[model samples]
Target: MSQAPDPTIHTLSEFLLHAGTNFQFFDLGRGVHPLDTQLFLDLENGLRPCPRPRQQHAWFAIVFWSEGQKPNHYIWFVKFPIDERGLLVAAARNHFLQIIVDALGQSLGEEKHDTLPDNPYSFVPTQSQMALFSAVTKSCLSLPFNDGVKEVEHYVNAPAISDWRKLSVQSIADFAQTLRDETTCHTVAQNMALYHEDFTRILLESAEAVSLPTAFKQHCAQYCADTFSSSPALALAALRALSSEQADTISQTLLNTLLDSKHADIHVLSVIAGRHYGQLSGHRLIQFFERAAALDEDESMEGKLFAGFFSDLVQLPCLRAEVLGVLRSTERSEVLARAFGHLFSQTQKK
Candidate 1:
C-alpha cells in the first residue's frame, strides 16, 4: 500500500479481509476475538486449496502456512483476495500490515533511521501477529526466533549472498566459532542462524560437495548436538547450520548423531526434523528408517535407534510390505502416535 497522509484511522477491517478465510463483508468487530487460536486452527489445519472466491474477507489471521520457504511453518498475515482468475492472491491480500501502518502512520519503505523503530501496532499485541511481523523485518537484520522458520532462501535477486557451496569446512568452522564471538553483532548471529536450512540444503544437494575438515565437522556437530541436547527449540537451528551447505561429512555426521544414535533429546530433534524437514526430504531419510527398524527391534537398551520419525515416513506403500508387517507387529502405539502427531502435524499440512 502507498503511504497515505491520514494515519490515525487504522482499519482492522482491511487486515481481516486479507487474512485468510472465506467470508463476505465479514465484520472484524463482530463474532470474533483477536488471536482466536481455536478459530485460527479451524481455518488453517483443515485447509484445502483456496476455492477461488468471488469475494473474500476474514480477520488478520496467524496462519500456519505450509507453502513457500520449505518446511517453514508460517503465521501469515495474508490477504486472501480472489483475482479475476478466481485465484486467492497471496501478496495482494495482506490486510493487517496496512492496519499496522495506518495505526502507526509509519512509512512503508526503507527507513532513514539507523536504529530499530519501535513497532506501532496495538497497545497490547493479541498474539504472535506483531511478533511474526517483527521477525519478518528483522529476518534481514538477523534475529533469533523459533526454529520452525526453517527454509532455504534461494534469493533470486541476491545471487552474491554468501555462497555456502564455495566455503571450505574451515570457513564454516570459522563461522560457527564466531557464533560465540563477543564482537560479532547480534545482526551477524541472526544471519548465521537463518542460514541453517540453506546450509543443510547445500550439504544435501551440492554437486561438488565441499570437503570439510574433520576437526571442523566434530566441532560444529558437537556444539550443535550439545545445544540440541540442552534445548530442543534450538535443534532446527543447530541441524540447519551443522548439516547445511557443508560437506557430506557434515550431513552424515549430524545424522549419525541424531538418527544413528539415541538420546532423549536426540530423538526429540529427530522427531522435529521428521516433522518439518520430512516435508522436503522425507525420501532421503526413509533408508535411515529402514536401518533403524531393523536395528531398533525389541527397544534394547544396549543399542537401538528410535524409529519414531522413520516409522511414520515409511507408512506409504512401495518399498516394503514386509516392512509394513514388521511395523505393525510391534505394539508401540503410544510412541508411534506421538511420532504420527508430530509427523502428521508437519506433513498433515497438505
Candidate 2:
C-alpha cells in the first residue's frame, strides 16, 4: 500500500502550487487591482506587511484553477488583520490555514473544492464589486469577453440607438477593464456628455476600479471642472474615476482644487480620503487634514469626522508615517489643533 502523501501544507501559495493549480491574487481593499504573486508570498511568510490595507485589514481575492483543465476557476475572498505597524497577524493567518488543512487535508489539489469552510475571514463583495472583479480576472487570463461586452461596446460606439438603461453593470465593468486603445477611450470620453446621468454614474463607478488611458483621464478632469459647481455629485463621481496616481498636470491640478476648497463638504472630504489618499503627501497631506478639521463643527458630532478618517488613513502602511508626522506638526491651524486635542481626549476615555 502507498503511504498517504504528506498532509503538511505550510502556506497558501504552497498549497495552490502543490494542488497543480495556476492562481492569481488581487487586492480588493482600495480597488480591484492585481497583487504581485511574489509580494503575496512575502506577505504570507511574514517577510513584509500588506501594502494596501483598508479599515485595518488586508482584503484580497485568490482565483485559482487546475492546469490543463477547463477554465472553471475557484475564488476565495479572504481578509486578515494587520498589526499597528501593518504586519500581518500571524495568529489569524495560522488559524485560517489550519481550518483549510483540517477540511481538505492532503487532498486539496487532487480534487476541485468548490466551497471553503465558513469563517469570519470570508466576505461577499457588493454586486458592482463582484462584476468588476470578474471582469478584471477574466481580462487578465485572456479569456473570451462576456456577452455583455458587445452590448457595452455597441452603446459606446453608437449611443443614439442603444438604450442606456438596458446596459447591465457587468457589461460596463467588462468594458472598463478591457478598454486599452486610445481610439476607444477617446470615443468613450467624447460620448460622456451624451450619456444619461444614471448611465454616466455607473460608467464612472466602474472606471474607478481600473487604470484608465491618458485621454480618458484628461477628459474626466475637464468634465469634473465643468460640473464642479453645478453638479457636485457627478463631479465627485468624476473625481473618483480619475486615476489616483494623477500622473498628468490636469489630474493633479483638479485634485489640488478639490483639496484646497475651504467649503469642502463631508462627501468631498471622504472621497479624497478613501479613493485618493495616495495623493496625500508633503503639503497636500497637511492640507487634507486641515480641510478635514475645518469642517462645520456639529455640536453633536464634534471631532468624529476628523477622528474617524484619521484612524482609517493612519492604519495604511504607505500613509502611517506621514499621518503621524501630521499629528506631531506644529503648523496645524487652531481648528486642527483643537480637533487633535478632542481626538486624544476621546481616546483616553475609551
Candidate 3:
C-alpha cells in the first residue's frame, strides 16, 4: 500500500503552485517593477538577499489568479523584515504562511474570496502607487489599456489644445508603461518639454517605474541641463524622472555637475539619495554627503537633516558599507567629519 502524500508547503511560491494559480511578483521596495520569479524563489529559499530593500524591509506584492469556470484574481501587498545582511527572516515568512493556511485552508484557490483576511504582514499602497501597480501589472499581462491611455495619447500627440489638469494619475502611469514602444517613446520625447510642468512632473514620476528608452533618457537629461539654471524646480522634476539602473554617461555627468554646484540644496541631495542612489559611490558618494553637510550648516537644522539622511542610507544593504567608509575616511571634509561625530553622539544618546 502506498502512503498518502505529505501535506506541506515549504514556501509561498510552493503554496501558490500547489493551489494551481497563475501568479506574478512585483517589488514595491525601491520602485514598482516586476520581480523575477526565480529571484523571488531564491529569496524565499535563503539562496540570496533581496536586491532592493526599502526601510530595512522587503516589500512586495503578489498577484495571483485561479483559472476555472469562474476565475478569481487576488493581490497581497506584504512586507517582511530583513536582517543586517538583507536576507529575509524566515520566521516572518513562516508566520505569514501559517496565517494564509488558517484563513484560506483547503479551499485556497477554489473559492472566490472578495477580501483578504486580517494579517499583520499585509499593507495598503498609496493611491498613486496603486494606480501605477495596476497599470504595470495590466501591461505585463498584455491586457488592454485603461480609458486613461487614450486621453494620455491624445494629449501627448497634441499638447496645446489639451488640458493637462484633466488627466488622471492613472492615465499618466498607463502612458509611462507604453514608453517601451519606439514610436510612443519618440513622440513623448519630442513633446515632453511642451507639456505643462505639472503634467511633465507626473509623467516623469510615473516613468520611474519603467526602464526608459535611449531617446527618452536623452530628452530627460537635456531637460535637466537646460532648466537647471533657469528653472531649478523643473530640472529637479526631470531628475526625479530618471531611472537609476539606466543612468548613462550623460546622466551621470549631469548628476555630478549638480552635486558639484553650490546650488545643490538639500532637496537635490535627497532626490539623488532616494532615486539615483545607484550612482552614488566613490567620489560621487563623498560629494553627496559633503553637499548634505554644507546644507546643514546653511539651514540651521543642527545637523539633524544630515544625521537623519545618513541613518536612512546606512540601512540600505548596497549603501551601508559605502556610507560607513565615508564616515571612516580621513579624506572626508572637516564639516563632514563634524557631522559624522554629531551623528555618532546622537546614536550613543539613543
lDDT of 2 by residue, 229-273 (tens): 888888887888875744356666777887786436788777777
Question: Residue 327 lDDT in model 2?
Answer: 79
* Model 1 per-residue lDDT tens digits across residues 153-177: 2221122474545544322322332
| lDDT for each residue of candidate 3 in 1-350, tens digit (9 for 90 to 100) | 32222267778898888877889999888777798889899999878888777777889999988777655668899999988888998999987877776767634644544355788889899987898888888888776677878888899999998888888988888888877777888988888768888788777778777777777788888888788777787788778778675436766887888888865888787778778878877888888888888789889888898887786677776787998899777679988988888888888988
Q: Per model, state how many residue pairs clash.
A: 13, 0, 0
How high is the CA lDDT of each candidate model?
0.36, 0.79, 0.80
Q: How much does candidate 3 score in TM-score?
A: 0.88
Query: Which pairs of residues clash in candidate 2, taking residues 3 or more apart in a chain or in different chains?
Result: none
* Candidate 2 segments whose C-alpha is farther than 4 A from its true place: 1-8, 109-112, 245-248, 296-300
Model 3 RMSD vs true structure: 3.8
Question: Which pairs clash (backbone N, Cα, C closer than 3 Å) in model 3?
Answer: none
lDDT of 3 at 30: 72
lDDT of 2 at 161: 90
TM-scores, all models, native as reference: 0.30, 0.92, 0.88
